[model samples]
Target: METCSIARIIRLQDLAMYRHKLCSLLFRLLPQLQGFPPGPPLKKLCKDEHVHVALTETKMVGTLPELPQDILMVIFAALEIPDLVRAGSVCSSWHSAYARLCNLGQYKQSQTPCLVYASESDPDNVLCLYSLAEKRSYKLTLPQPPIRSRYLIGSSHGWLVTVDERSEMYLLNPITCEQIALPSVTTIEHVKSIFDEYGDVCKYEISWHTGTRSSRKPPSIFALAELRGRLQWKAFVFPDTSTGSYIVVLIHNPQAQLSFAKAGDDKWTWLPPHYLYEDCIYKDDILYAVNIKGELHAFDLSGPVITMKTIITIPEHYDCDSRYIVQAPWGSLLLVFRIVHDHDLEPQPGASEYWNTSEIKICELDALWTKIKVINCLRDHVLFLGHNRSQCLSVNEFPALKENHSYFTDDNFLWTVGHTNNHRDMGILNLDDNNMEEILSPQLCSNCPAPMWITPDLRKMNLMGSMSQQP
Candidate 1:
């Protein structure tokens, strides 16, 4: 009984307070009920509908009081450097957010993850570098006007390796705007020596059927120089007839062989005769030289002689046309290349039908070197396998498509330039569940830029053997 009485009294008190103002005004004007107690009656009149109206209006405006700058800075500092800068232009309250973003020392030890250099088929060909962890994009200012170079060879640390149309090499730190000139090679003497060895150097023809070529002069070699953080150039005649000598021996085309140059007080050294038949890739502490006979050889930087162990010898019948190899997620290496189109595929003459055919293969490098047939995409194919996918192309054959490839986390999410017959755009192959989503879409760049290699973070780079380099 007592609880019920208390609850009833509370409700009555609220009602009376709500009615107090109007009731008092009525009583005063009318000179009636003047004997009523003002205080108690006013408390009863407080439950007015106007109170609800005022409360609702206040909530409509999303007004969060300005937090102190110190608190804002603390919150912003937790964000990645790029996110904080992006928030700066939002409003004055966010200005403090921007200030805390440039805490540069916090990122010094991390090696800035991987630096990404991006360019398109624009007339100006603007090159930009992005730090994956910082999520910040810095435009690369070329030392002079932009050159006609459209290919990126590789990147080490913050330095970007690139080559031009005529095979001129240049290295640049997109972050510091520093450039280094690299020795360029127009032709290989080993390739010429291979022909000389086979007696195919005389007046002959380059026939596709017999893989024949005429006598040709040896290739020219250039010495690379980096001075005062600026690039300079010098030319030197190779096959130095003096004390320094490099030899060439060809096993395949007799046109492509190996050349090794003697290291004479200079840091740069090449093995001659530089064999043209063998293709090489450097990773970790070892350099891999694979000959045309499907023989894999390893040369150690710490040791004087190459290892005698047979790393891998692929069978010719299995197709050994892989042009690129990368270390995969784990310790296994990935070899990438296309399977030759079946010559039996005869075109339908006078028919408007177009045939799409290609076979992309992947081989894992380990003790046994396991091979897995990974994917088959349409049109001319290029493959990138890694986190962020920012290395160089397997081969620097295409100029405009030097830095144009983008890889997302999802599987079979393939995006490439000119993967279709249409020249105006690019295509994507989403093979998540074996169902291919062939999306033919337009690109944002004017020049149909090809996808370049992605440089992953330090941890991933270490996985892909980016920690060491040839001195």
Candidate 2:
């Protein structure tokens, strides 16, 4: 009987210490609860005082014990990215919980599309992320090597692919601050310096001079010309890297040809050239490209030797002026077209001179990739198309976003000399109503990079064996 009584007393003492520590943590975490009664004042209890009495007193006055970690996790998981970050700083347990939830990929469930833009005046290579759901803007600085000095060519799986002045490539995750350096510029087969002894020539200057002298210029003359530069990456798509190997497809050079390189390969491998290539996408381990004639070509990247096959040819009567291919959340392919009106070459007083997106047409491809069906309504899906990447999100995942609408940024001929600072060209296209509404206002910085949609994700790349070159 004596031993049992001693054991009970020891257990009570440990419980008391735990309760005190938890209350201290809570008090530090929640400052607003300072004025709230913090239970009976700590005092030396008499030998006769029962442990039940102390626990009952704490139960009546303290609120920390009522909220367990499991319950707290559910609450934290529902918070937006910004709020969740703040909650992690409150306590060590909460921070651990946040890390666990992130490892489990629960944070991605709360993510929505955000508009990422760069400020011409920000010296620290900062990019602004505007949240459509919260209607707020967050400034984020990318990690080294300086991202502002590089050109953003593509964005996929929450990572931005940037090419530096020397034509080197890097993958940057603005949200996680993680960066992966891909193969060097010289690894590309056809990448050569225009100025032989200048080490590496600036391709932008060469392309700009060439564009100025061209007579029969393309409608999206400036954008297409810039995209065709040798140093410019043109377009790139990142594949799933969880399988220990991944392929990066790029359309580069003045000819806009297709090339690819495996994750650890020292050099890029050239594929059969597709000139005047508008866009490319990777769906189910296969690469697909669209040319000026709206012909779709597929490449099987799963094999040791990549083989290209012509899959679908869009009818010439559809009159595909500008084309982009996007895969829906449910694994369906969509072809989006931007139809423009070619008015007089000269501008009139009080009128916009640049060509605008007069109409948008969407077409759905069958599983066999044989027939194309025109889709007037997008149902519950919203599409975001831009120079970086084109993606589709289901309205069911983000209820705040409007359904059957297309959000677009500056692409192709939308950016002209006179319309450099205008935001009126980029807007939301309502597929159901056939109405376009301006979504973002013009920024004060005139040289800001065109805005693009970025989906926040926290997955880190396996860069253990990857090669990197110092800038």
Candidate 3:
């Protein structure tokens, strides 16, 4: 019995030494396996060679360390804004990299234009940002300016210019939830104050027409202006705001008179009124506008006193309904003309009272304003047209977008019916072949605000306080 016990003891010692060496080898190979559960003492594990083998395999297959920061940044930079934001949530290192990229403006290069539509579920405050590349919609909620009574009049440089029922103006960055209030409505030249019996301003009236009226009460001019047709306010923001300097131009009332305010102004300063201004755009630090007569004028905001110069006159055309001025991505200015025909003013059986868009005309303006030419083909570019803002984008940057198309939404003439059912009005217009087709078939509820295109930008802006207070 003593001889047998001695032989068993020797064998057990050999097994223990083997197990110790095996574990040592694994730890050397994988430094990441340091915190792994320690195996049973060799004496306890001597009978189970299978467990020893299993542990060895497990330690050898340990997970790899996280990717390096520089390498992660390169990968994240290529991702779209929404995806990049999600990646930042993975860990602290990734979030730091995202912040650095935003500060450096690296993410701006990866952004493609997105169609911003009012959300059907929460149309008042929530907006749906639809990505053409990803074929998805992201819901965004506004934090300020009380979107319920506000109207989005302009979108540019990632900011929306909104006006409320009280004619209060606000600049809001939907992405960052930043807001800046512009000059007040009482500051406008055309607004007349109506006081109460106590000598307090109770209401305000906009003196749209100054001339004498007919004997008849003119078909309830207020309702006609609100429903059928009336001039709408349009605003344009200067491209550069790095030095805390920016200008906003407003086309006021049905007369389309021009007024402007600077960064520190407390009131809007009226410029020499122009005749029947239709649309305005800001390009190359200058404001360009078009009138009902299709005349283009450039307003210079460089000096304390703003100056206006007539640039070019659009060739005369019949049944002209509306005009829009847009700046192309390549710095070219374009005039989009909407022609309407009212052959049958009366509605027939099952007929709707919507104006038919007979034709669309595009024209390019020369830099010197000496020449204007009609353009039928938009080479590698797509135009987004609507009431809020009109913009042109190049397809070379957005490979998923179709080239040479014009996407349109509802305007005053087509507002009687919702955009979803008005297939004849809102859709993509093939500039190459002059064909119109439906792009979105959303089941939007009636009276939903029309969608607009907004180019996502992350640049920081100098935001003042709310409308009731100054910065």
* Candidate topping lDDT: 2
lDDT of 1 by residue, 13-107 (tens): 55334433332232232212223344433332222111110011112112223445654454444443333333343345555444343333222
Query: Would you list the clashing residue pairs of candidate 3?
Result: none
User: Which sequence of candidate numbers ranks them by TM-score, best first?
Assistant: 2, 3, 1
Where model 3 places Cα greater than 4 Å from the true spot, the runs are: 1-65, 145-148, 195-201, 209-232, 241-244, 329-331, 341-351, 356-358, 413-424, 463-471
Residues 1-471, candidate 3, lDDT per residue (tens digit)?
354345334434554445333323322332323334444332222222121100111121233334456645655656665555545543456666766776665554446667666644664677666667766666666765456445666676677777655556788766666778888776776565567799866566555542232223232223211321233356666543323456677766546677877777899987665756767876445778888887888877766667888888777654567788887777778888876663344668887555555567788888876777888878798877765567777787777778988776655433522233333345677766667675565564224345666666555565342111000
Which is the better candidate, 2 or 3, if ranked by lDDT?
2
What's model 1's lDDT at 167? 38
Instruction: Give the alpha carbon lDDT tens digit for every residue of 206-262 in model 2.
Output: 221121133243322222124323345455646533344456777664455677777
Q: How many angstroms is residue 127 displaced in model 3 relative to the true structure, after the best TM-score fit? A: 1.3
Give the lDDT ranking, best first: 2, 3, 1
Question: Which pairs of residues collide in candidate 2?
Answer: none
Native-to-model Cα distance after best TM-score fit, residue 107 in candidate 3, in Å: 3.1
User: What's the lDDT for all of these models?
Assistant: 0.34, 0.61, 0.60
RMSD of 2: 11.8
